[model samples]
Target: MLKTTVLNTAHRALGARMVDFGGWEMPLHYGSQIEEHHAVRRDCGMFDVSHMCAVEALGPDVKTFLLRLIANDIGKLKTPGKALYSTLLNEAGGVVDDLIVYYLSDTHYRLVINAGSTDKDLAWMAERLCEWRLDVCLIPLRTGPTAVAMIAVQGPHAKARVWEVLPEVRPATEKPGPFFAVEVGPLCIATTGYTGEEGFELTVPAAQAEDIWNALLAAGVKPCGLGARDTLRLEAGMNLYGQDMDESVSPLDAGLAWTVDLASERDFVGKAALLEKGRQRQFLGLKLLTQGVLRAHQKVVTAQGEGDITSGSFSPTLGCSIAFARLPLGVAIGDRVKVEIRGKRLDAEVTRPLFVRHGKALI
Candidate 1:
């Protein structure tokens, strides 16, 4: 049986089209997906993201352990409630998973990883702790019964709508530093989001999620679904796992090199291999010039070599097809590549990402 979130009934009541997503029954859309996408871009919209797993790491050596475990530098997070985005890697320098870690204190930290990779992430951490002989405790926080539900309110007016609905949350989040969070009552409001727009991700108790969702809706916050979420994230230049990257791919070749901190003297798990085998492949963005849609696993043919589309789709915001491709080293910006879609060669221009932001096209 597939797992369901606490807000499943509420989503169904709102006429959401539910589908199985990574073992969790999630809403693909409510009525028209395009309308929901435009609602977020023009106003505010909320998404039920409670399916994400939140785990806590405890122990006196938590800071030290995380520095050696993740690719990003934990020391960069100097303030309490500050967050860092990083990727966990294996010995071969391949990506194990990409996650967000929050620094709560010196001895306690919070990690929010993908729900589908929960068991594997826990096992990997346990084995690594054993190997390092580290004195630390990793605890997986249960979301179904005891934990809170998470809602992502995104768009240009997203923050304003959240403030209007829950006036108390703003005082704490108004002057929030970037990538930082503030706790208000039973809610944790963070000023970070996947969409390239101003927003807040709120985490409240599961029992209270329905009330909050209703209140937000009454306050003019549109209810969005997973389909809108994908388009927004893709336009924002953010990567999606299993589509843009996997266990076989490394951060170096996934347009995520900036997240990896190699300058630090800290000895991370895959640092050595990354340093030795880096700079071979490259990641680039593609804008389709032909009248066709680009999808994942499509073949990309370049003059220098061949590559594959990591993530591709007809961008709802841009009204054109776009994709992220892992190409050879010789692939550069302004180069024209051929993408095989339906066994026909379609011309596409290689470019940088961030195709859309703040309801405006950047490409």
Candidate 2:
């Protein structure tokens, strides 16, 4: 049986077309996927991201445990409620999982990881904790009786809509800049989002999820599903776990070298391997120049060498097909490439990975 989120019934009531996403029964779209996409790009939309797991690390050794656990430097998280994006790597310097770590204090921190990676991530974390024999404790916040549900409100006016829905949180949430979160009563309002838009990710108790969803609905926030979320993230040039990268792919070759801190003397799990192997390929964005929708695993032929499309979709914001491809090194922007679609080769232009951001086309 597939797992369902606490807001499953609410999604069904709203006439959502459900599909199997990983192991979870999630809504693909409520009515129109494109409209939901536009709602986020042009106005405001909300997504039920309750399926994502939240884990809390507590104890005095939390900072020490994190410093050697992930690739990014956690020392930068001096201010409470500031969030950092990092990847957990195996001994081979490949990506184990990409996650967001929020700094609450020296002794406590929170992480929100991809839903599909929850089980393995927890097990790996547990195994590592045992190996290190640290005093810190790993607590899963998305399970058991104390589970929480997360709702992502995105777009230009997303923050304002969240403030209108929960007025009491405004005082706490208004001041934080992007990538910062604040704890207000039962809410953890974070100025963070996947869509390339200003927004807030509201984490609340699972019991209050339905009420919050209804309130957001009543406040005119369009209910988006996984389809729109995927398109939005892809258009924003964000890497999707399992699709854009996995255990075999390094963060450096996946266009995530910035997320990995190699400069500092602080040794992490994959630092040595990353330094030894170095970046092999260039990760870039492809804009289709001809008629045809781009999809993953398509063959891309460039002057440098052959490459593979990692993630591809029709970009509603740009009104064209866009994709992320792992191309051979030395491929430059404005270079023309051929993408094998079916039997015919389609023309595409290589550009920076970002296609659309903040409701505007960057390509």
Candidate 3:
């Protein structure tokens, strides 16, 4: 049986077209996927992201454990509610999972991991903790009495819409800059989001989720689904866990080199392997010049060599088919390439991976 979130009934009541997503029954869209996409881009929209797991690390050795666990330098997160984006890597420098780590204090931290990789991520962290013999406790926050549900409200007007529904949290959430989080009573509001827009990812106790979802809906926040989420993230040039990369792909090869820290003398799980393997491929964006919708795994033949599309779709904001491809390093922006689709080589142009941000087209 597939798992369902606390707001499953609410989603069904909204007439969401449900689909199985990584073993979780999730909404693909309510009525029109395109309209939901435009709603988030032009106005405000909300998504149920309760499937994602939240884990809390507590104990005296928390900082030590995190410093050697993920690839990014967690030392930069000095203030409470500061967040850092990073990847968990294996011994071979492959991406185990990407996550957001929020610092509450030296002895307390929170990690938000992808839903599909939750089990594997927890197991990996457990094994690492045992190996290091650290005095730390990993608490999975998706179940039991303290469970929480995540709601992501996004768009240019997202903040205002959220304020209308959660006026009490406005004082605590208003001052934080992007990537910062603030706690107000039962709410944990983060100025962070998956969509390339101004928004807050609200984490509320599971018991209060339905009320919050209804309040947001009553406040005129359009309910979006996984379909719009995918398109929005793709257009923002963000990498998906299983699609854009996996345990076999390195951060350097998946357009996520920025998330990996290799400068400092500090050693992490995959530092040595990352230094040894280096960057082999270039992760970039493609604009289909010919008449065809780009899809993943299509053969991309460039002057430098052949590559594969990692993520692709017709961008509603751009009104064209765009994709993220792992191409040869020599390929440059403005370079023309050919993608093999249905035995036909379709023309495409290489460009920076980002296609849209803040309701504006970058390409």
- Predicted candidate 1 versus true structure: per-residue lDDT over 86-159, tens digit per residue: 99999888888999999889998988899788889999999989988888998775644657788999988998
User: What would the TM-score be for candidate 1 when compared with the true structure?
Assistant: 0.97
Provide the overall lDDT of each model, using Cα atoms, as 2-decimal numbers: 0.88, 0.94, 0.95
lDDT of 3 by residue, 1-363 (tens): 999999999999999999999999999999999999999999999999999999999999999999999899999998999999999999999999999999999999999999999999999999999999999999988998989999999999999998998899898888889999999998999998988999999999999999999999998999999999999999998999999999999999999899888999999999999999999999999999978999999999998989999999999999999999999989999999999999999999999999999999999
Q: TM-score per candidate, in order?
A: 0.97, 0.99, 0.99
Clashing pairs in 2: none
Residue 211 lDDT, candidate 3, scale 0-100: 98
**Of 1 and 3, which scores higher on TM-score?**
3
Q: Give the TM-score ranking, best first.
A: 3, 2, 1
Whichever of 1 and 2 has more lDDT, that candidate is 2
